[model samples]
Target: MVLPPLRRLLRTAAWLLLFAALGALGLLLVRAFEARGKPDLMPWHRIVLAQELSADTLDARSTWADVLAREQQVFDDLHAQLAAAAVPGEFRYERGSRIGARAGERDGNRSFESMPAEPRGGVLLLHGLTDSPYSMHALATIYERAGFAVIAPRLPGHGTVPAALLDVRWQDWSAVVRIAMRELRARVGADAPIHIVGYSTGGALALDYALDALDDARLPAPQQVVLVSPMIGLRPFASLSRWLPLYGRFDYFEKSNWIDILPEFNPYKYNSFPANGALQSYLLTARLRGRIATRAAGGNLARLPPLLAFQSVLDSTVSSADVVHALFDRLPANGSELVLVDVNRASLLAPMLRSAAAGQIDVLRGTKPRAYRLDIIGNLRADTLDVGEQRYDPGSRVPVERPLRLAFPSDVYSLSHVALPFPCDDPLYGTTPRADEDYGIRLGTLVLRGERGALQVSAEQLQRLTCNPFFTYLEERVDAVLR
Candidate 1:
């Protein structure tokens, strides 16, 4: 009897060992297949490779001007190497409307300053990760024209090149936000109310900074906050993203460092995304969540400013559920509001969409007597494409719905995370571009019809809506609050 039991135990151990070995083999094979060729080097990659990677770190810069100069050098180096190799539509260092690199021309990426002698108020805008100040241009322009002294600082790793993302950390980004805010506050004294507008990842930093101000008295406090598709919570993939850099440590898997190493096509945004970007975002969001929780528990939540956030319900980058549950739920009734954009119902994919998506309207706004306002922009009649706003007022029991006179185009199914900040007439990402200025290629209007796998970019990326049809309504809503 003893011998029989021992044999069974031995057999179970052998099977477990076999399964573990198979799992290891499968993971190695997946890694090997992920990045087949030696990926093309970005401009900053080539320059940084020539020296210690620390040379690319942004912590050394003492002033924003120093930041601009270092960025210019990177662009100058990129131009020298790839100007001849670049095509007209592609983003070349010399020709691309690079945020801060036009040494002789208007550099949109450089820190912008529009200050009046007697400013009504002040606004500091922070662009998203891997994005330059141009991402914040339309919003910045709107606030500047509204008599607010506007200052938009280009985040260190950004506004220069894609490879700059390789060595930076979340702490570096938070440090820059502090610097930019101090500069803005100095320009507009204590009597002026200040606002911080963060788009995407910048949203995480803005929230983190505001939480820090609650305890650390040195930090400047914003009168209110505005976030666009804020990275309040990221995908579960982020926890795995940090492991990618470790996998890339081996000579066999260096290409794993990048999530999507693609052609630099868009002028304002980096086409290529790095694993480190995801890693830092994870850290920032985790940190922000913890601080918010701590504040809520200590009864310190009253210090937070009124926040206005705009998010696409179907964001590929962040968890929309977290926006409602994590950030907005913890607030202490300070007039915060969340504006949610629903997907287009007219698209054929609407049927295929998970039923839970439409349910988010009710799910995000639990029972009334809630502190925050929830606004859902979608089609009231499921079969029709006409867009309308369903506003659930704070502390009210019933939701009020109204028609906005805006309708989704037949081909457009949803607004993407990057689409909310851009208007339909935006020169770069617009559907019906105003064409006030040319950026050589019109990315917004590209309607390519071809066989699958023939194009350089994935069909899904091309199919994603790049501009918002109801941007006018968004602007009006924002202006109403500011006025």
Candidate 2:
């Protein structure tokens, strides 16, 4: 039996909880209503072109030919539907437009193979969510030049409309990775080495595949797994996104399905982000975290392959600490390495950094014993922008400092989540786009100065650094791994 005063307090608390729930619902509806006046939904958002394959179809039995056929059908439908239904606009869906997907490589949005005569090995390149095979194009060239046959696959539901993300499951993505791995294994044969290079969500997929390979002998394990800004974990809010889409099931609240409905400006990537996309990512990472824990507890992770990961110290997209605590800390004494691109401490903006952000390097360099090597790339001193590498070997706190012929650009405060993959001379997102190649639009070259309400996208999105200044260093490190 409860006391009378306690019962009264409990009743009041229940009422307050109900009111808070109601308030949140009201706010969501208000935002949905406001989105109705933003921009009309394009054909790409509404149409699902390649509707043939299911998660069941994307299994070990499936061939790369089948995936390519489905991809071809998708692009065909996209070209036809957009040409007929889509109006001539400045957006990417416009047919034959400069910024359109069709204006680029004939097969830019699909899975592609780069073969070198008498290849030494094979490489499987997987891109991020909402990003097409074009994201791996530059890296493919690097591997190809080094005499490796490269297979960069456009993951299921990606390189197409943002609406396609709504129906796709993380399992479908995993199956696709398996199929691609089999293809690369076949191409390179049984003796030759095979590697996986994953960026963002692809990084999660790569690591998950590696973990699965530990238990399953049928799977082909990678020689080395390379990750860039891997999605090892997501914020707590992403898990809650699953419930918000309940209202979106109704036609009246369709706008609520999208987190952002920005114009599809980039040809290779989706500007608009959907609620299901976030939900799927959270589910994938959550399951991955659990798998890592289970494997570590069982000591099955000892056989796991060496992993080489590159991450920014302050990433806006994924949790950097999760990379350290969840994955790296649990590893065995394999030759795994983590390269953290630290903030430009010599920058004038250094003083403006948040207290937590400023202290991140110290947190990463804690006295705890680590199983893997840790390398931090940043300023050597507070007074100069000259960069150097600080190498911390396994179980060692003392760092061996090596000066590099590199320096942070005076204007750049830090590298971003999206910047580590591409070189400075990249045609699409380079600070100085190559004069030879044209991708219709050079996003990295834009320096806009206008009023706040002038653009649909935020000013911050345009101002974010898109390409890496230290890409040469990244390339050399990867090349050394290949050698």
Candidate 3:
């Protein structure tokens, strides 16, 4: 009887334990699903419409007024969602306004401008693949404040719906840049200088514009170029497509380990880009990179403009090495300058960092600045390892050893890829600084205070109030250049 009782008790305990374990696992799975399945605030529809407008392919019946109305609807929907989620208030806007728009008589192209024009020439801002002109807004604002007129054009197949991005070709993006450049020239006058600035895939397009198409007498060439974390190469583990031998397909892959590690700075974190769209982007980048490299090597130095490329040492999506190699190494001797901005730990710890990397933060630090003069043909060697592997290694550090030498004869300039977009605090709706706490307001108040302002808050005081990694990097770069 005692033995039977003991066996029954033991059996019951095991069943209970198993049930508890299963319940815990179920809860975990639910949490994971929730995290992965959160509805994107920026839906695919908006991106597609924006892209259509950029490409000039949308039906004539689809006017900017229609597009703006749809965008308003999308914004309202997103605002409700963000509000419910307790996002910041300053970050929310019902309609994004255009700072300037001009109708030109030449091509009859109407150029829409978003940022104020600065005397330091103009910058054409291009957003990343599967992203809208929204991504460039913050950066454009920064450039505007820095005294550069910013033109952030909606790429083909973006700013409407996600599906449209699938139909867009690399040429579509290139075409928009070309048009935007012409518009910039027309707006600023034919002799005025201009620079092209691109984020992610847009960076590649900027280079392609400078190297391939801008040389024609009809188009004005860029004086300087700024690339922000340019996407030169995709993750190596992406599958190869059967239809396209060279294309890397990432359709089924959602949430890679690298993305999980970084902070989420991107507003479109919830969006899912199509696999084919990604593949197309990869193919285009690869092709353009090759072409620029060839042009740089042939001593055709006059064809390319001075370039500035910035890459996050810890960026998960794009290969920094390929970008440096293609643009920095292939340029003409004494024609281009490359600035590498290493994202330090303090900078990577921002709330948005988690979106870009997995939960863990990787800080990139460099001791000595490497300079390259004229040796464009010398092969630039970069460690072709996954950024994750490098981060995980206890002793490994960000590799900035390879000097960017120009092999071709072009006036190409490359800067540290990440600093082109001056960083700012991205507060969702309710969380941004209060009206009284606004930086601009505070600055104005300080100016009014005069003696008190000098005693209490200096220029540095205002800068510290912004307190962002991107801003810090900008201050440093500006100081270095001025010095």
- Who wins the lDDT comparison? 2
The candidate 1 region of ten consecutive residues with least summed lDDT is 47-56
Cα lDDT tens digits for candidate 1, 1-483: 569889999999999999997886677558655764646655544334122122235452445555546556655655565665453433545344342233454565556768887898899898998888887878877787778998887776776567778777888777778777777787889778889999999899888888777777766799889999999999898877776665666656767777887766676777788889899899889888888887788889997889999998888888887888888888888889889988888777787778886566667667746688888898867888898988887777687999988888777777889898889888778988885566656678988787888866787887677788888877887786688
What tens digits encode model 2's per-residue C-alpha lDDT throughout 153-227?
Answer: 888888878888877888888888888899898888898899999999999999999988887889988988999
For candidate 3, which ten residues in a row score worst on lDDT? 384-393
Report the number of backbone clashes for model 3: 68
Model 2 clash pairs are none
Alpha-carbon lDDT of model 1: 0.77
Give the clashing residue pairs of candidate 1, or none.
99-109, 100-109
Go through the candidates in order and give the C-alpha RMSD of each one to the true structure: 4.5, 2.5, 16.1
Which of 1 and 3 is ahead in lDDT? 1
- TM-score leader: 2
Q: Give Cα distance to truth, residue 381, candidate 2, Å.
A: 1.0
Task: Tell me the tens digit of each residue's lDDT in model 3 across 1-483.
Answer: 569889999999999999997886666445444434433333222333331433455332444344445435544554464344453332111123111111231110122364354355677888777666655655566556666666776665554334455456877677667766766666666665687878888887887787755467766788776666777776663333212211212322222111112211223321344545666677877788677656656777555665555554445567766666555655654435444433332322333444444221222222222332211111132221111111111122333333332221111111223324534343311113234222212211222233444432234322222212334443344333222
In model 2, which runs have C-alpha deviations exceeding 4 angstroms? Answer: 1-31, 34-38, 50-52, 100-106
Provide the overall lDDT of each model, using Cα atoms, as 2-decimal numbers. Answer: 0.77, 0.85, 0.47
